[model samples]
Target: MPSGSLRGQVALVTGAGRGIGREIAIGLAAEGMGVGLVGRTHETLTDTLKECARHGSRGVAVTADVTRHGSVREAVRAVERDLGPVDLLVNNAGQVDRAEVPLWETDPNHWWQVIETNLRGPYNLLRCVLPGMVERGRGRVVNLNSGFALRPDGNYTAYATSKGALLQLSDNIADSLAGHHVVVLDISPGAVATDMTAGMPMFQDMKTWGSIPYMVAVTVDAARGRFDALHGRFIHAGRDNLEELVRRAEEIREADARTLRLRPYGPQDPMG
Candidate 1:
């Protein structure tokens, strides 16, 4: 049965061809939302679209890359034309560092490519999608972020740096959308066993993996306003009880927890 509240609404999910993005698209569809599946591969996107249709949901697949602003704008237009104004935007398309190599040891082209795909991609989507949301006085954005953003890891410099920037971008956008009634969430799917993760050197030796269903559930809840209180806050799907977090949203927000920040060495330090 389709869940209530989301029926008839629309969602545009990037990287919907596979992995978490694929699952998220289907999850929203099951909840009765029209979905736009955006990805570089038409065949894979069409596969996801068909799955969404099985749930009796409307969907469209666009074979487009996220790194190009004009391409993203056109993609958004096509999705809106098919599924109505986007009520939710999921920036799920991203890549990780190719190998466990230090910054200088990494290939420069690959490093910049990662930067473009991870950081620039989300920025492009937001630029194209936010105006309508702001005008409508309602909408939500979910940026697939990571704990990597909160800490440093020399090996995955590009990936970590991009996510950290994205984290701040979400925080700033969330604050800007206060009066507009739009909320942005920075969430980490948390080591899900996707191809992206499979290629990651860190997850290769791990036996345990994050739950795709749990991650999907969190996304649906976010769309339905369950986690609106945690807007601009980082939500890790594999850890932290969501119910408990929601219950203490005010405390978390006031404490300014779960965001990237520079720690000062002393009270007199400017960063503090």
Candidate 2:
């Protein structure tokens, strides 16, 4: 049965053709949300849309490359026309390097492609959608982040760099939009087995994988504004205990934890 506080809300999920984005779209639909599936592949998005309808919610697929400004505007318009103003925007589309090569050894073209897709894509979507959200005085944005953002990795430079910037983007926008009731959050799906990751040599022999349901649960929580207090913060679906995180929300806020920031040398530092 479709059940949740987000029942009648509208959501737009980029990269919804497959993998984590696909699952998130269906999960939201199962919770009775009208969903707009955004992706580059029409066939795959159509299939996801069918699954969403089966869950008893309205679903529409808009094929568009997120990296393009025109495409993003079109997708946002289509979603709003069909599903109403997007109450939730999931910036799930992403790209990683073709191989695990060091930054100095990476292909320049492929590296830039990853940057454009992973970073510029979300910027485009936000530009297209944020105006309407601000006008409405309420909205939520969930950026699909990764542990690679914080942890230093030898390879996947573009992916990591883009995500780290994305985290900052969420944090900055979260603060800017706070009074407007538009919360932005960053979530790390945490090494989930997906089509994008399936081909990675790193996970070839891995046994345990992150839970997709748990990731979806966190997404839904963001959608319902359950974690608004933690806006602009990072949440790791596969690692931290969410209930405990909720209980420690105040401590987190007070300590300015779960966000990217610089550390001072001491309490008497210049800035301090």
Candidate 3:
């Protein structure tokens, strides 16, 4: 593919104020896609907007809360008014409990708040953006996910649960949009050294971490539909060899790999 294949395209990335979201927005703009920086902080979003402008791609900043439907709708409208209808949507805004504790011991309000931010945040964006994508018969969605979605985290119930639900959400949407040319993918950046990770007690002494470049590359690929064959599947940026995964795309579909699904017992089992 050409370097500027995404020229003139528009991408709206949530949580674009800082961390991985900020980096991804700049990277996308560097690839020739106009970017919409959506976040709660005007100053930080403006900072990212300026960086995108340095890349020679148009950038617009919109302040909005992802968990609110009306706010998301307005943000989408603002992006469209300035950039264009979003061709790529990155659902990267998320939150984790400030303190890790068992579900029962955790504050109920905080637990649900995390859930609302992680899951409902994406839901709100999807509802606002997908209608136009579907109408145009094309779009791409990259849902930032985590390993905890596949494995339970004893002390991180809300985060884990929301991510797990997000995986299912991606799969379900993929099914609904199969022939429409709109693709949805789940990407796990795997412990990037971000503000969120730095604040986590479990990662306080961690040394090794995933590369942000790899994560951005995966997002870029998804935006260009390079992984359409693996739509609705999870991409583990830190571990999965993307080239090999692409080569074995057929095999993955045949074996039903990289997606969330019920584990089948032996063939003799009734459910199997």
Candidate 4:
């Protein structure tokens, strides 16, 4: 909650080469977190390193493909060697293929690509990072899920389905790690302007939603654990009711914790 609360913390942001991931990496650095920028492109990763340096935080640019476990593992090791152990992990790498193709008409290769990047990538990072975090007993994980995760539309079968699965993954992680002081959450940026959408037809249609800066700010808050109250919940960007959304999430968590119902009596239950 205070400025620089993340000072001395090490944060790794995947896909930090550009777009929303770039902004999130820069934002974390600005908050005094040493940042590891992970992406497949060396050029874009270099840019992110410059941005983090400009913001006055130590940064390491690592070029790695998230879909490959070996690549991600090596990248994580490099970051740990350069910036110390990671205190935070942002699973932001994602891809959307065949955006115009319906589910039935989608190319199998394109569909698998989307799933690999969007879903498997996060799983790899979590698997690589969770052991260290659980050993330390303190860490934070933020998954950049999309608004489409909750509300899907036409022609986004691969992207939307992957994001929806990501949300569920975050939820499971939250439930499992709550006692470890490791918070896991899914954030929906709500149509921020990014290179991924810049030339798309939907870009013009969604330009009025919000810019990347606002989403970055919310993400920074999430990193500092300000939104711990909303773990296992979703938060939308550009909404006028963030406070209300957070309150609702807290209420939901509390309700779930308080209400425990028994399952229907099964054959295995002798008491039934």
Candidate 5:
């Protein structure tokens, strides 16, 4: 909320090796927050850590498979040892299906692999880091979600389903964390140009791309407590008018907006 407000804070970011994750880690560092760069590749993580250090922020490059609970725990332990208790958790590690094929034509093993990485990755990290955050009575989690999670996609079924499940997971946790002084927000960086997206055939024809810097700003705002009021809700960095959302947080809550829900047919409907 104020200048230097984030100084001395600790942030643990999964998939901090590259893309949006690397941007987020550096942004946090620029705000003077010590950052833990977690990813499977040590070289990339080290590169990110070096940049974070340029901001005079403490940083650690820890290599670990996010889908494994034990590996995640050890990684978290290492970060805490180097950077202090984690004040923020950025769940950015995820992947999409290699081919944008229909479910009937998709390889079952590959589908499961997508689920394991995209869904289970964040689950492992959340479980490992949340207890400490709750104990400390302060923390924030920013889940890198996707627009695909909100609608049915004819292709990339695995990616869509896993992201949808992740959205549900975040929503459920937000309710459980109601009084814990911790907040979790899901954000979609719509079709940003990254190594991952570049490999995807669908994005090649796309002209406009999401703003990487805007996504970084959103994370910074979350860490600064700007989006605490919108916990468990989905925020789109590429399209959302965040200031309007914050100004009308009360309206959003009253109307149950920005969340996954069953639409009512009419006022007389029992589900409404």
Candidate 6:
């Protein structure tokens, strides 16, 4: 069950022009969140806008290439001016330039492009967004990582490495900004039938997982901080084992909260 409400909040979803990002944007809008749709192409973004409107949300579309810092900064400013201060950021923009090449055989340029789009792009957005969130004392950040981040396969060197870095970055941010009421999480939405996988020859051989709607539910849940106790944790969508994971997260949060109150000097104390 989806467990969060985002009424009146503003959410920015990168790559919202299509695929998983589009689904996430629409889902947030359906849940009463104002949405900012961003993508490299305006036409694709317009499609997202229509979806948002259909869901009865205040939506704005912006064209920006995530790989460029200036472009992303501009997009964030536009979103704020058009919507409101961004309360949630879904770092969903990513690329896979080394899809079928071994690490040694992959072109350096392709590898770098993947890394730039997947890792640096998110870093740029966070740098531009986090300060405002800290000032507001509330925020949600969901990095769209992959299952390969935890378990990598061959011919996915670029994609896997970038997501791995993103997961680490999310953990580090979660730890550093816990006191600011900011929740940073890495969500690994299992294989969805997106364009990224549509043309892969072996795509059909893999197990079909949950659809985009399921991932959207998880995104909305994370944005409301319903999973705040799970900060720094990686969540896998549609996996039946999440109940235990959520319980453990709550336990950890309770423990952390108690420690903060009991011993302010503890290492885990955000105040320290």
Tens digits of per-residue lDDT, candidate 4, 176-237, equal: 89888888878777776777776556666663757688888887888777788777776666
Error of 1 at 230 (Å): 1.3
Taking all chains together, each candidate's TM-score versus the true structure is 0.97, 0.96, 0.96, 0.89, 0.96, 0.88
Report backbone clashes per prediction: 0, 0, 0, 0, 0, 0
Off by over 4 Å in 6: 1-4, 250-272
lDDT of 5 by residue, 98-197 (tens): 8878899989998899999999999999999999988888899999999999999978998999999999998888877868888999999888999989
Q: Report the C-alpha lDDT of model 3 over 1-272, residue by residue, as the tens digit.
A: 32776899999999999999999998899899999899999999999999999888998999999999999999999999999999999999999977878877999998999999999999999999999999999999999999999998988999999999999899888888878889898999999999999988999989998899889888998888889889888988888889998899889988888888777687787766
The residue ranges of model 5 lying beyond 4 angstroms of the native Cα positions read 1-3, 265-272
Candidate 2, superposed: residue stretches over 4 Å from native: 265-272
Best by TM-score: 1
Whole-model lDDT, model 5? 0.91
Give candidate 3 misplaced runs (Cα > 4 Å). Answer: none
Considering only N, C-alpha and C atoms within 3 Å, which residue pairs clash in candidate 4? none
N/CA/C clash count, model 5 = 0
Candidate 4 stretches greater than 4 Å from native: 256-272
Estimate the lDDT of model 1. 0.92
Which pairs clash in model 1? none
Clashing pairs in 5: none
* Ten contiguous residues minimizing lDDT sum, candidate 1: 1-10
Greater-TM-score candidate between 1 and 3: 1
Per-candidate Cα lDDT values, in order, are 0.92, 0.90, 0.92, 0.83, 0.91, 0.84
- Superposed by TM-score, candidate 3 places the C-alpha of residue 234 at a distance from the truth, in angstroms, of 0.6
Superposition TM-score, candidate 3 onto the true structure: 0.96
In model 1, which runs have C-alpha deviations exceeding 4 angstroms? 1-4
Give the clash count for model 3: 0
lDDT of 3 at 16: 100
